[model samples]
Target: MYSPALQPLFQSLLSTLADLNLAYDRDREKLSESMKDANLRTRALEKLKQQHHERREPYLQQLAILQDRIQRGWH
Candidate 1:
């Protein structure tokens, strides 16, 4: 088990990650359900890609930092 002090932080991080995953899933579903027109579908998917990247990068960075910190703590 993780240290008592770190468990809450771990849970919070997991919750954030779960939320991000759900948002991404919804965005993907929207992309799949977008207009049948080829050009419109392409545009919609690209827009979603850009938005997802913008949101995910920072979250992934933070997650990586947290992982690094945990690994360092373990040593």
Candidate 2:
């Protein structure tokens, strides 16, 4: 078994993941607005797309760190 201190850290990471997921969902909704009745402006859509792309690397890095901590006993 791992240290008890790791529990809170794990919880915090889980919370962070949840928040990130919401941010991702919000970005996706903005990207999808064009498909729906709402007209997403080209400039605005491009900006949002760029923002999402920029966030991709950091989010994936965080996910990888969390997964590593999980399988590697919080090393």
TM-scores of the candidates are 0.72, 0.48
Candidate lDDT scores, in order, read: 0.76, 0.68
Residue-level lDDT tens digits of model 1 in 1-75: 345676677678778778877998898787778677878888888888788788777767776776787778842
Worst 10 contiguous positions by lDDT, candidate 1: 1-10
lDDT of 1 at 36: 76
Per-residue error (Å), model 2, residue 65: 5.8
lDDT of 2: 0.68
- As for candidate 2, its clashing pairs are none
Per-residue error (Å), model 2, residue 41: 9.1
Candidate 2 lDDT for residue 21: 66
